[model samples]
Target chain A: GQQVMQIPQYQHVQEGEDFTTYCNSSTTLSNIQWYKQRPGGHPVFLIQLVKSGEVKKQKRLTFQFGEAKKNSSLHITATQTTDVGTYFCKGGSEKLVFGKGTKLTVNP
Target chain B: GAGVSQSPSNKVTEKGKDVELRCDPISGHTALYWYRQSLGQGLEFLIYFQGNSAPDKSGLPSDRFSAERTGGSVSTLTIQRTQQEDSAVYLCASSRWTGEKAFFGQGTRLTVV
Candidate 1:
């Protein structure tokens, strides 16, 4: 069985600050996907990275996969109140398994 | 556009009761999956249905849990003799295939009291 763990279980930042969360795994991952879930809401897909050392960006968010395919990160630049949510990193095999997630809270 | 819809957004049931949750996936999508999220279990895969054939039930937690897909459309997950440990949010997602990305439904929150 494979398990993914995320660093910084919780983080709070000023509205204009930058925030990043890291995801690591003990086993090699075939692919990784990022998701954001609002309070009391379901997980929404953000991005997916399959190749080693792959990097993708969406506006203010940047996702990267480690060269070994065992780690990943999500960085949000100039965060806003709307970016407050739990971010998850999931390792995909035949099925997808999620990490505990990093809860981001932005303050004004 | 219509995404995915799940029924009875919230469910509260007593121990030993059987409950069923339904999910309606996006039209023309061939892949549907079920997962459970809880503090103790993170996000665990339950089952996945591909096309009209039988589903992959390998991820189910126990024998008490079962699911069915009809007409290659809607799906229903049934939990028999539910226990308190079964309380969690059940999420449903559908994709074009096994390797593609997926779209999720709001999920059904189940609380076994």
Candidate 2:
């Protein structure tokens, strides 16, 4: 069985602070996808990384894929109250095995 | 369709009853997936349907859970002898055969008593 584990199950930060969540897989992954779920909303795809040691950025958000393809990270710089949500990393096989997710809470 | 659609936004049933959740994926998509999310928990893979090929039921927690996709257009997830543990938000998503980003529906929230 394949498994993707995430750290910092919960994170709370004040507006203008930074937040980061890490994900690790038990086995190598062909690719990894990140998603965000708003309070009481379904998960929305944010980004996907395929190449090893790849880093992609979206404004204040930065995504990184490990060189081994077994780990990934999502970092938010200068967070805002609107950034409150759970971030998930999905991998393993092609069935979308998702990690437990890291829930982010921001206070203004 | 513009996006995935699921029926019965919420469901409440007594123990030992049966319930079925429906999912309609975006047109022209060939990959459909079902997952369960308990309170404060992550996505729990239930099954995967790819085109007309055999489905992957490896993530199903028990035999009571089953799903089917008709004409590769719509899917239904059925649960028998529902238990309290079955109370969770069941989510459905669809993607192209290339396995790109998946578009999800609002999901059906089931609460079994």
Candidate 3:
């Protein structure tokens, strides 16, 4: 079975601080997708990275896929209170295998 | 449907009871997935359906859990002899295919007493 592991299971930071969560997969992934879930809400799609050593940015967030396609990272610059949520990464070929997720708490 | 729809946004059942959770994926979508999230926990993959091929049930935690997709559009997850630990939010998602961005439903929160 394929597995995706995320680091820093929980994180707390002051507003404007930067935060990063790392994800590693037990097997090489054809693609990786990022999702965010707000408190008391369902997960929502954020971004997807496929090519080797690929980097994509969405405003304050930057996502990077490893050259080997075995790992990925999500970096949030100058985090805001709205960024407080759990971030998940899914990786695999046939069925997406989700990582344990990184919970980010931003305090004002 | 416009998005993934799950039935009975919330449910309460007693231990040893059987419960069924339903999910309707977006029209024309080819991939559907089921995930469970306990309080303050991450998404736990339960099963997956892709087109007409055999479903992937490797993520199911126990034999007590089973799911079926009929007409490749709607899915139902059944948990028999439920336990207190079965209390969690069951989420369903659909995508164009494997590895694609997925859209998730609001999820059904199950409480086992």
Candidate 4:
């Protein structure tokens, strides 16, 4: 069985501040997928990192996969009120285990 | 369907009653997964069905929980003798295959009172 652990279970930041969440896995993953769940909404796929040490960015958000392929991170620059939600990382080859997720709150 | 579809957007049941939630996955998708999320909590894996292979039921919390996929299209999750702890939003997702991006349904919010 594989386990994915996310750090900083909850975070509250002022508007325009940056936030980052880390995801670590007990075993190496073939690929990792990031998802975002807004309040009262279902999880939506954000991006997927397949190559080791890959980095991808979307707007003010940046995603990076560790060179070892056992960890990943998501960083948001200059967060806005609309950025309030939970970010989850799914990692694994067979089951695609999901981390508990990091809940973010942006204060206006 | 364009995306995964779950039935009964919300449900309320007595503590001792049985309830079933349905999921219709995207057409031609081979992988379907069930996850439960308590209010303000994280997603908890429940079950997974891939193609015609045997389902992975290792995530089921207890004997009261069970799920089945029919003809590799639709799935039903049944909770027998539901308890207060069984209350949560049950989410269903589908992907073209394993290790692919998953598309999740809105989920069925279950309330046990």
Worst 10 residues of 2 chain A by lDDT: A90-99
Colliding residue pairs in candidate 4: none
User: Chain B of candidate 4 versus the native chain B: what TM-score?
Assistant: 0.99
Distance (Å) between predicted and true CA of B108, model 2? Answer: 0.3
What are the per-residue Cα lDDT tens digits for candidate 1 across B1-113?
Answer: 29989987999999999999999999988898999988533567899898986898989999999999999889999999999999999999988776467788999999999
For residues B40-62, write the lDDT of model 3, one tens digit per residue.
99888899999998999998999
Model 4: residue B23 alpha-carbon error in angstroms: 0.2
> What Cα-based lDDT does every candidate model obtain?
0.89, 0.93, 0.94, 0.94
True contacts kept of each: 0.57, 0.75, 0.80, 0.72
The candidates, ranked best first by TM-score, are: 4, 3, 2, 1
Instruction: Tell me each candidate's TM-score.
Output: 0.88, 0.96, 0.96, 0.98
* Every model's DockQ: 0.55, 0.71, 0.79, 0.81
The reply for model 3, stretches above 4 Å from the true place, is none
**Ten consecutive residues with minimal summed lDDT in candidate 4 chain A?**
A89-98
Q: What ranking of all candidate models by DockQ puts the best one first?
A: 4, 3, 2, 1
The alpha-carbon deviation from the true structure for residue A70 of candidate 1, after best TM-score superposition, in angstroms, is 2.5
* Tens-digit lDDT string for candidate 4 (B1-113): 98899999999999999999999999999999999999999999999999999999999999999999999999999999999999999999999998889999999999999
Better of 1 and 4 by lDDT: 4
Stretch of 10 with least lDDT, candidate 3 chain A: A90-99
- lDDT (10s digit) by residue, model 2, range A1-108: 467889999999999999999999878988888999999999999999999999999999999999999999999999999899999998754777788999999999
Better of 1 and 4 by DockQ: 4
Q: What is the descending lDDT order?
A: 4, 3, 2, 1
Q: Which stretches of candidate 4 lie over 4 Å from their true place?
A: none
Evaluated at residue B41, the lDDT of candidate 3 is 90
